[model samples]
Target chain A: MMDKIIRDNYQRETKIIDAVYPRTYRDSTIVHSDRLQCVYDVFTYTGDRLNDEGVKMNLMFLHGSGMNRFIWDYYVAHLLDYKLGAAINKIVTLDQVTHGDSSVLNRGKLGVGYDWSDGARDACKVAQKEFYSGLEDNSDDIINIVVGHSMGGFQAMCCGVLLPSLFDFIVTIEPVAYSPNVPNNSNVTVLPPKFFKAIASKVEDEFKNEAEYDKFMHERSFFTKTHPEIFERFKETERINMEDGSIRTKMERRQEMLCYMTLHPTSYWLLDGAKHIKVPVVSLVGGIATWAPKENQQVLQKSIPNYTVDVVPQGDHLMNIEMPDEMLKRLSVHFTKFAKEYQSKNYDNSNKSVARREEIFEEIYKETERNRVKNGKPVLAKL
Target chain B: MMDKIIRDNYQRETKIIDAVYPRTYRDSTIVHSDRLQCVYDVFTYTGDRLNDEGVKMNLMFLHGSGMNRFIWDYYVAHLLDYKLGAAINKIVTLDQVTHGDSSVLNRGKLGVGYDWSDGARDACKVAQKEFYSGLEDNSDDIINIVVGHSMGGFQAMCCGVLLPSLFDFIVTIEPVAYSPNVPNNSNVTVLPPKFFKAIASKVEDEFKNEAEYDKFMHERSFFTKTHPEIFERFKETERINMEDGSIRTKMERRQEMLCYMTLHPTSYWLLDGAKHIKVPVVSLVGGIATWAPKENQQVLQKSIPNYTVDVVPQGDHLMNIEMPDEMLKRLSVHFTKFAKEYQSKNYDNSNKSVARREEIFEEIYKETERNRVKNGKPVLAKL
Candidate 1:
């Protein structure tokens, strides 16, 4: 079932990969007892980074909801096809808290408690520690392109807001944001800070074996867009083998919903956050009538100064996973365009700063009240 | 796990359903079949066809690839929410030949031999024998609606062409057609009475037990949009429990590719066939850059006079299986519009014809040559 196109041949050389960012985010609001650290993978090509005259860019791939960094192995392995066997200088991918290997390392405490907003917060921290810090010496000399789908797209936006100059270009594929037109689910958390139980009460959380889960996922319509190996990769990285010899998703059900609940307020923060993005941003709409309201992008385009929208008509929210080639094609074009423009201007690291770091956290919580007053969306508050 | 909204409370009733159209399309030039018939299920509302005052119509739903008639159970079972326990009067759904009970009945002969074109041929024959003949009495007083996804969409076009007057309206969802932009795989099946064996040498065919296959398919991303019972229903109808204690898909892997190959030439036949559709037709694009070429839909819209397109943003080729609500929403809008317009001018069944039935087979082969001469996609002539 493993697609050779995605994980074999030249790919066979750089197959096994994992990175553990040792710094734990101790202040996680939702999972009070849990200690979570960022886990990521760095994919370096068969040869050294293209230092010579060649079209090169660094990539940070952000995965969507309930997905681990390993899901990105498909793109990392296949992006080599964009060129004969090289394009990116360094590829960095990460697992958000309550997801993938990071949660497994947290032991049993990484429960159904982590929120969506915390994911963005943790993502920013990881990018700062793993990627941005690594670029401390070179700084803005190299172009860093962030390609994200779904929740990763949402977190990419947070990364943009937190460190405006870190990523030179960002591509968002089917990231959900606040849409006034979409009716709020009735289970939105109330002010006393009690957690909302899982809406997914009926979802089967465990399978008898690997083939069972594999066949379960393989038959669905969504994976028809994904290469089989990616799911195989996810199965390896994101599911746990229980004591009963059954496999279950790394994300527990209630905690998964809590991720949605915790990050619920940030949807309102997005339009306002659009003002802070100094870099060129591109939004990819998966389909016209998608889960993310088209109006969210419309509102974004209207609010932001430098923004463009790409419509990959054949894609759904998971198009990044569905059609990586088209997604890569878009990223390559954007990188080339931005590199040329920035190169012409002789852009440098002069404008970079840690000054916004303090203000960024304030912005996430500050906007919550403003949004609540405006009846934007229900905001999450601690107990 | 059943989604409460899709299958609970009201869904407990009407558990038994099955209808087999017995007449074999042995004359089908594409399949040279020993015997073949379409298997389908019919769902009648609580009080029969509410012909007295309901928004009366007869609906036929054709499923996508590797699927059978049982998938429609979700839509039929859940439609009660639209009108507090009632909606459409009669709903009919079918399994394409070489699938479901039809394949089971065909025994071992239903192998890589089944072609996609033959599927349309069989569907046309089923509609002719069961639907058209039944309507000989009620005729114009009733409206016939055909809704299909993926290959079903392609076959729906075939149905529209073969019997233009039989169906009053048709809706196509992410249906496969052809475009020169799409790269033909390395194997462009050349033909001259030779059977090209299965290209799927790598596919894992059988599991040790039904539990293994069941648990495997239960975990894939594609089925996220479908209700669990539909899959369970599919397992019941389409998979065979072998005597040696193993489970194999009723659809062999080779038959799937041959479905793509056998009908390869028909992509060129589509534009010409579109000219024959007199009824109002609507095409739903799954996404911008999907497996089904955007140019295919563009060409269809250009060729067909009475046609419209609705872009379902959140869907890929399997949109029918993913977000059925959105699919149904588009259908409802189309039905409402067509009903109001056709109501203004009384339409009748005088054009119904058996005379053209003989010509349908001749036309299939005739178009094959014209398409080949037009430098159509390489067709599998049968090896």
Candidate 2:
């Protein structure tokens, strides 16, 4: 039913742009994908000057479900100013394939190979195509940053591994990284195959009609109790309507299910990728107490040796939306430090460049190792 | 424009019903009044029958805007259990005229005299009507407490004065009582008429078209960002809709304006009312340093000689929603003490109920007074 709705309502249009800002830009396009055949959209901001001495930053933003790119409005607005001021080099953000104006997938889209990693890969492809294309044309220096929240957090980790060269820094907010040792069959961790089968069979049987399907979606969606005001806004921008008066998501339901279902590798893959990378990484975890557990943080810190995690005290999974100023402040601090390090190399033409980088990397590794030890855990193997 | 959208999309057939429990048989009714032209739901849980041996304690609840009686779901679900079983006698809740499935009033439908005072009066009427109806129907006996939050706090204050007989104890959560003499309105108390006009104009402009209006209502209403999940559920329940391709609010814009535009008389009116009321009153103020000035509390304490005020740390206007456990804990403490006094009076015929009640009330009042004096300013009064 969701798939049919997406097919009926999905619409996409793209226009190339000469410039978004800063770098005498050219070749910009917008893509609209369907989630469950509903129209989902993504706006790509491609760099203009490929050979400029600019630090390329790839920002893959993952918005929570029921919201779109508008959640990043403040950040985007700031980026516009940053670009003009040359404060930032370049940025690329996409509506998650299942969320924003992206396409909705079908329920059949679930399983090991079709999970969040696929979504991250899709996002990486978009960034690689845009940034790599710019690099290919102009040879501009590129530094990648991947950021996501909730499901987006899951994707950010996926992208960290799938496109290791593309992202030097990765930040995830409240990533739902369940431990492999913990029972995945629990309702809170992952829906068991039996539960999925029941839900799928029920949806197939009861939601044959668009209205029934839409009603079912509204009823079962995690955001069922969302404020009417917000739900209405989401409806206006995030969903597409069918000719039969039924509605479906623009992103593929299958993609969304794939994002949730394929978590077998755990976030360990991303942690391993982080070990191989030579860039700084940070994660902002909202300490909601009710949702994100301390165990998850412990696991992430244990696996990822070169990552700094800051827990925002009274924040939820949507920390970026709920506490934008705090999130921005922390991000700015990390970025400024990275920028300084990148610039410092120019003044010191010492052969210690590799050694200095290694030293910083070793410092991060030591801190993470100490943390693991203090928390009564085994030391992670160095990359 | 909002007024028109409400008129177009208002659900006239909506009804409120009480959830009856076996232990406590509370009388509940849904009144469809032409004055508001919507359902006014009232739930009255009579005190547990103690064979006229226990004191009657009545708690009148006033929930915040954009929330129905469901906001007190925790109170009903947890607090009212055995923890508070021996402390209180009865609990009563009413859906204010324009809120919940309560009566939806359009502009000019309620007489020109309508305002916050009128809202209080309407709530009092419901309480009294329920009280009398319960008495006639032999629904448990007791009337002693009044609890409200935000706008409900204001209503609770008004009810305290207008219906003094109904409550022997009161709990107000962040009640905004304006003080005309306070310098500069430092507490941001005097919400300028311009603010309301600006919002009204925005609402009017946004709701020009039915579809557009519905969309606008959904995005701008209080329900938008606060609790998206609940809002979606409401939409699914058909309690709210975006059917016209525009957002139509379940609540009338005029009613919302009435809440913000209207202010309780800040001067001697409240003080004098407080003076006339012999009931013990506890005002729970959220320590929203950004929004609440320190001077307001001093003024409030000075005005109500018998009043006890508590400053909840790191709390906001939505304290009930934000810190329900704390609020419930404080309320339970006070109610327990009151219940003990009543029980003592019954057990020992020589015990003076008035003296005992005054003793506890005086202790709370004196403590609050000292805190206010020490803080060096009347914060609540200033606001």
- Using lDDT as the measure, the top candidate is 1
> Each candidate's TM vs. the true structure?
0.40, 0.36
List CA RMSD, all candidates. Answer: 31.1, 32.3
Reference-based lDDT, each prediction = 0.55, 0.47
Off by over 4 Å in 2: A1-383, B1-39, B42-56, B65-68, B85-90, B103-108, B111-113, B132-141, B179-239, B242-245, B264-268, B289-293, B347-383
* lDDT (tens digit, per residue) of candidate 1 on A29-123: 22222235666766544454453334356678887766678777777766655542214666778777666666555544343324454555455
Report per-candidate DockQ: 0.01, 0.00
- What CAPRI grade goes to candidate 1? incorrect
Model 2 scores a C-alpha lDDT of 0.47
Across B124-205, the per-residue lDDT of candidate 1 in tens digits comes to 4455444433334334455667878788888787666544555778888877765332123321223221222222322334
Quote the lDDT for B184 in model 2: 32
